[model samples]
Target: MTRCLRRIAPLALALCHLAAATPAAAQESAAAEALFDRGLADMEAGKYETGCASIAESHRIEPKPGALFTLAICESRWGRVASAFTRFGDYLALYEQMTPDQKSRQGERAKVARKERDRLGPLVPELSLSLPPGAPAGTVVKRDGRAVDGALLGKGVPVEPGEHVVSTQAPGGPVWETRIQLAEGEKKRVALQVNGASTAAPSGGISGRRTAAFVAGGVGVAGLVLGGVTGALTLGKKSVVEEHCGSAIGVSDETACDQTGIDAAESASTTGLVSTIGFGLGLAGLGAAAVLFLTEPKQGEEAAAATSRRIRARVLAAGPDGVVIGARGAW
Candidate 1:
């Protein structure tokens, strides 16, 4: 409890001693004043994010020395030392404009703000980004989605400690992007090297091999269905021929098969042949589909290079005798 009290004491003292305004609040709109009061209340309630947002909004609506001071303190509480330091610098600028009474009222707060800024100096994350020599004119650099001024290039600038994205691009040139994670007080220097590598974007929705595999699989399924139908037809015709030829051809050993029986036998033979071809083609297609689906290359140049090694498959009639299926190549 004592340690906790010690931690809370400084913030409580700062809140109590600091005047929220350097000048009277008379010039601000009722909405701004209300928001400012609400922000302060929120901070006192330990709703730091809401408080900071409200305070920032109030400042945006009406620029007040008090809101600036509050925003700096809120940022400090939020552990964004870089932003707090900058905001404190902004608050100090109003020092010169205060009346004697205002100065007296704000002196303690100014001292506290200065000390806080000094304390946060070494705990802030900084980044130094430099482009390669002779980087094209009109090149732009961005840090965490915000554009960095060209003038600040090659110089260390304070940033919030966490993950950040650094990107640079020139008109008609390649874009370079990298992510960096920083700890408290960490400093990093990055030198960007541009290259011809293109940014990877998904193409044609699905990969070529995968799409082909799906198509081949579909065809294979259709062929299998046709094969099944032809097989049933062959069986039905054979059954019909047997029914017609029943005991007549074998009893006398010389009774010629009737036209209906002969025709049925021929039809069955044709349908059986069709069924065999369909089965062979269907099996070949399904094998090809399995290979294609399983062999889809992963992302990058290696994938592009592997296209040549993909499986190739074919279905062909073996001869007048039967159908043949074949495949070759690296999967």
Candidate 2:
């Protein structure tokens, strides 16, 4: 009986130790979950700042990032320029995991983007127009839809007869100068850009996403290398522990000496594997960037070709509203 008791004592004690560790781990996880939920709620409400904080805290525990994306969109709507930049991070994280199948679809998306990017250039206001008889009243000069303060009646303001530009500054956007012309009547139309690298002429294929993938993938690769080193060192520690303690280390002894070595090895191995994945992701990102760079111009050319919309009118009139009088022409 004494011998049995002695043998069982260590096992029971170890069990108790393990049991004590469980609640702490559970509590930590619960806290992380709570934070994540709160972040999700904030994101839905468009409270980006609060959402970001909650998500970041939760991420430390769970290491996920849906909340970060929600926050970025909210910030963009509010015109929070700085936060918009932070939102880009969420896209970068997700992109690192894209497979070849996903990347293959990028070309199609790039084509559409390029088409829109160069849809129009700065409006060149037409000069020396002969005003027709009975030109309609309330003919407001517009460049893209706002009031062009102090734009000259005789001075140049870009137009294409269907777009509007009512700006005080230079119509600073691709299609910044509109073609919306007023016939002394009125028209309503609105178009949205998919917000590429912002400039009057968008850098069609930037998508801003490729750059992020490149950076994150690089970081992941570096982490892999670091993890590999750590794993190697931990293995050495494991050797030392086994040499000194033998199999007894994991038996009823539970001296904690071998525990350190085991923990080190586990941590190193886990991180090392993760690091390799990161490294691979990094390389892929860089490669993707190269691909995107080469692809954009091709896409842009296609888009331009498509937009070569020619006009073929049998007969027409000439007026401020475009041949409002008697004329015949082709576009």
Candidate 3:
């Protein structure tokens, strides 16, 4: 009696669990049927977008050959040739797995699906992709944001008619992207290339920034020396003018000067102008040198080179009248 009761208790629990799940299953079936009906109504009203969406949802809730076939039809009328073709193939495949009685019921729909799939086979566009010679190994290719199989490379593969984005990336290389458009029944091939070489300076070497800094420093020192020499010459000329023309350093009495005094004053003015220009060049060069040295990149020669390329310094000696020196950069 005790053994019998144990067996019976297990059976009772199983039955109770089945009963509890029955209502949920029924609810799902009801919802799927409702969606299917609504989708059909929408498609008949020429609203393919909403109709297809509803039907797809209904198929997701409860997969059925009828719903899939209807969805294929909706997609066909909506001009999604690739989608319609794939869905029709799916319906035919599903029909093959149905039981004898089920197959009998779905035979007509299966025939239509096969016919449609065959009709679209020639209308679908094909795209072939190939890598350029010397392409790096482990390169990844994608079409429309989906990964493409390596085996499909250089082979014509079916694609939907319209615009598509193709992208490729190799190890340690920059991503390459291109857009392509195809019409129905069109076939096209594309050759992809990757720019993988680094543009940075080589390792274990002086960076561009350092080189620029040295150049700027040298210019600064030279400018300073020129300014000093020119300034001394100006001072000597000024002394001569003062002695001959009764002109002090800041005060010039031209009426009290003869030709020699006037000549001395002119020489002093020209030398003073050269001195001023030299001083300006020296100051600007030194400032640029300081900034470059302080902001030099520490990553590597390559990074420094990239950073230095953005910075530019120009110095022009405009025939001793004035000197122009300035630096421009991104940051």
lDDT of each: 0.78, 0.47, 0.82
All-Cα superposition RMSD per candidate: 17.6, 42.2, 11.4
Best model number under TM-score: 3
Model 1 error, position 326 (Å): 57
Candidate 3 regions exceeding 4 Å error are 197-331
lDDT of 1 by residue, 1-331 (tens): 9999999999988876565553345446677888888988998888989999989999998987878999999989988889998999888878777898988977588888889989988999989998775566777889888899989988988999999998888887777899999888999999875554232323224656677888888887887787789999999997777766747556443334678888988998898888876776676678778877665566664456566565566554443344555566673
Ranking by TM-score: 3, 1, 2
> Candidate 1 regions off by >4 Å?
1-28, 197-331
Query: Tens digits of per-residue lDDT for model 2 on 1-331?
Result: 9999999999999999999999998997899889988977887787767876787687677664343444444454444433444444445545457687764644443333333223322212232111122222323334435443434444443233333444222233223222344331222333322211133224334444346545644654664466466556657756655644545564655434465656655665665555454444444444444444443324335446336432221212222122111212232
Off by over 4 Å in 2: 1-257, 298-331
Residue 27's C-alpha lDDT in candidate 2? 91
Which has the greatest lDDT?
3
TM-score between candidate 3 and the true structure: 0.56
